[model samples]
Target: MKNQTTTTSVTTGQMFRFVFGQVLNRRWLLGLNVLALTVISLLEFVIPQYEQYIIDHVIPRRDLGLLTEVVLGLLGTAIALGVLNYLSTYYMGIMSQGAITNLRTELYQYTLRLDTHFFESSKTGDLMVRLTSDISNLQSLISANMLSMIGSIVTFIFVWIYIFIINWQMAVAVTLTFPLMFLIYRVFRTRIHNAFRAARASQAQMSNQMQNTLTQIDLIKSYTNEDLEENRFGAYAQTNKQDMINATQNQAIFSPLIDFVNYLGVAIILALGAYFVIRRQLTVGQLVAYLSYVAMLQGPIRAFTQILNQLQQSLVSYGRVMDILALKPAITNAPNPVNFPAIKQGVTLDHVSFTYPDSDVSENGPVLPAVTDITFTIPFGKTTALVGHSGSGKTTLTRLIDRLYDIDSGTIGFDSVPIKDIRLSSLRKNIAIVSQDVYIIDGSIQDNILYGRENATDDEVWQVAQMADIADFIHSLPDGLATQVGERGVKLSGGQKQRLSIARALLKNAQIVILDEATASLDNESEKAIQHALENLMKARTSLVIAHRLSTIHSADQIIVMDDGHLVEQGTHESLLKANGAYAKLYNAQFS
Candidate 1:
């Protein structure tokens, strides 16, 4: 959905703000976590000071009482540190999980509101990766890396100030490595981010490939293309492997280089502190305490390098997640939208034209519109038939009336009010479509039927099923309405699925019904029964029927013939035959 070419670069501060905004919602839990971390940091600083007391004061005075007191102080600090650490870790887990849960729910709900065009153009696998794996990356940062980074920062500041107070000269010499380490991070930051981005892309590709291959396993086996698909999958796996290795390669080189710098600082401080002790300018205890402080400082520096690696990876995931959230649906409700009024004058399209956004250019030249300058009406309480070949835009016309897409030109009206002015929910609730391609969820027969009207009574569901002539087949099954239809209704026959779809529409009891080749999959006997049921369903309501079998719509009150996105003819079936125009030719061709 995102147009990468138009996307601007986001700074680190912006990314943090966006991510932390979601995380900081649980203020009480975060407050407790901060309190624990602060206390833990202060306790860490106190422990080394106790070590200095024993060496410089207690041991030198040979005072057993003071030694025991110092030991008891050390024990108390360690216990307090342990308890605070537990509380901090526990509280952070709750905070991070809560934040991620809310974020995921919001992302999914927003994604559902996006236009149909977005789904048509995007791969399911890639979207799944964004929703699941990408979000998990952010969770990992919050739960583990982010909290640790905060602690490291606190420790670094406390130890740095303490070391400087004890001996500024040694502290100054030790900190020379800081600038070099920072320079190394700056140099590798972009390189590491790019590598991780490549890895995430490759991971998405692999997920998409797996989803495609697995869902179409039937096609693969029928054509005996298993080996072909295997090889293809293997290629994606290999690419992902190479990408991960490349990402890790950047990290592996960067991490140890940071460690080398850190220890080098420690080495320099060790030598300098020993020199100060021999000069009598520093006590042995002070030198030991200073070395401990330097080690404490190195912990944060080393942690910072690891945190840098995670920060880069988390940014990549965050960017991917944000890209989806940034997209605004092309089709949205108008401001102050009113509910669609009850139909009286029927539906009208005046010089309507539309071209799909994802339409591709052909060898001839630019892409052509799917429909053009079409003006027609479906009279209220009458059956109107649309007769056309494939890609003649009959389906597109139905989609437009339902407001699944907006027309590029002209106006579509319902009872003299513009379709766009009506509330989308109210408009769609009045229309029911039973398309040729029926999609049944992995649910029970009752569940699928109930999808049409969520609050419909069980008796009402059965009545519609009986009217659609699917009751007989349903009765034959052991579980009847309770029978499970496997994924996409793979367990059902073609005609059965179509009938189930009709049963769904019948239960909807909408004011306007569009049957696009609804009976195309049915046998002659089933088609006749469905036609009779549809006649009853269409009475006192507007109906638009599309079928290639011209005989199917011969009894319609009005017929419209379309060719290559243009309306070519309109008349009753017998009248069209008398004129011997486009409608007549299509009808004759089928019978002859």
Candidate 2:
């Protein structure tokens, strides 16, 4: 698990560029939307001119037939604009949604393929938030919001041309307010950016709390810390509320200010036009046309800034999504992958050494190395055990062999080729693991056993279940193998869950087996059944066992003892006990 509350930096312009770039590849869709929107913008420009013509020409001449014709023309064009706008928005929606879905799928797939080191160094909840909320933000930006901003910009450009054509002097006067408006918009943007960052930080904090709380709800209730947890949650929520308020205030303040600027700009335009009309420099109709054009331009102008604000949010989320997409898994298959037929061919670590990239005590603290110069071998069809104290690097050594992590130096090999050279799918296919913390989905007993290997027939499922000694109990159940195991197999006892996990491994029919504290969670009866299952599974396979209980690995063909990233002892259990070293001390301490 990663430490809480690490900050991410993503700017608005970068996000817009990334998202827009994604759209550039879809030339057909882009052409369709832009063309439709262009027609709509052209229609919008015509509406103001048509109104000006009706007032200046038809009304002055008092020709009712001309008046009726112009009214119908404007109505027809208005309807056409609406249709074009709908078409543009419709196609844009499809393109945006498709892009977002594609991006999200790739992001999700990349996250799953990342090495265990990345997962260990990152928070699950933060990743979850990125997958859900951040994706949603991007989706909105693409689908509806972004297209509207594009339309606004197009409309502003067309309206500005009309304003300039009517009277240059008046156009210049209205344009002057823009710089002050932009200055005020800049101030609003700064405040809103800070507010939004705070809002996202609070959200991240809240997500971490929820993930921890839900996972450990039983612990909270057992320790009577529910109230404490609630207090912590509420405190974070309060910060979220405050951040939202600040963002709302920062953005909301701009609306009235912009409106005031619009009002003042219009007032100045009309007053100047009135003086020109008195001086016979401009007519009533020309003044009215300029005023109408300015009014039309104001909305699109204000909308442009509002869209820019939303763009900032999308950019932040875009950065987060890009981060996950760009993260290369530390452990990946070689360019030309090797395929291993079976794991019984044995495995070897030739001078393997490993240290976590970001696992350090402090800035200048001594870095801990988890494995060092570890040269060892487990021969084919043999059961080998690893014995170590906590933090002695036992788990790290197992993970190294599994290639959940890559070794910093030397090589780990199976079938005479480095594990890294083997295709990831082929490598994992040959091994099965039964760990202390067994996981079962909320599914039928059969489904849990055959998870991912679900095509196994009824006979095959039952065959493995019997070997794991879970068939008899499953048969006794009213639903047999169809019995629904509740979330994470909570419906079953610890011993029962362990047996089910063993059955799963048996069903895999893998050539290598790893038992990581597999029987530690069980009672004697359950442990005996699991041991029986292990013996059956290991018959023709190589096996590596990590045992806390001393008697579990007593009959192992070999035992390797580890302490502080180094091998302290290796031999048969009896020989190690006779050696009276770290292995002997551990054995006596547990069994004495």
The lDDT leader among the candidates is 1
Q: State the lDDT of candidate 2 residue by residue for 276-325, as single tens digits.
A: 99999877777887787787678777776766557556666676677776
Question: Candidate 2, TM-score vs. the true structure?
Answer: 0.94
RMSD in order of candidates: 1.9, 2.4
User: Candidate 1, clashing residue pairs?
Assistant: none
> Residue-wise lDDT of candidate 1 within 345-431, one digit each (tens)?
899999999999867789999889999999999999899999978889999999899988999999999998898899989898889
Give stretches of model 2 more than 4 Å off: 1-11, 341-345, 362-365
- Candidate 1 vs. true structure, TM-score: 0.96
Instruction: Give the range of the ten consecutive residues with the poorest summed lDDT in model 2.
Output: 1-10
Give the whole-model CA lDDT for all candidates, comma-separated.
0.85, 0.81
Prediction 1 global C-alpha lDDT: 0.85
- Residue 30's lDDT within candidate 2 is 83
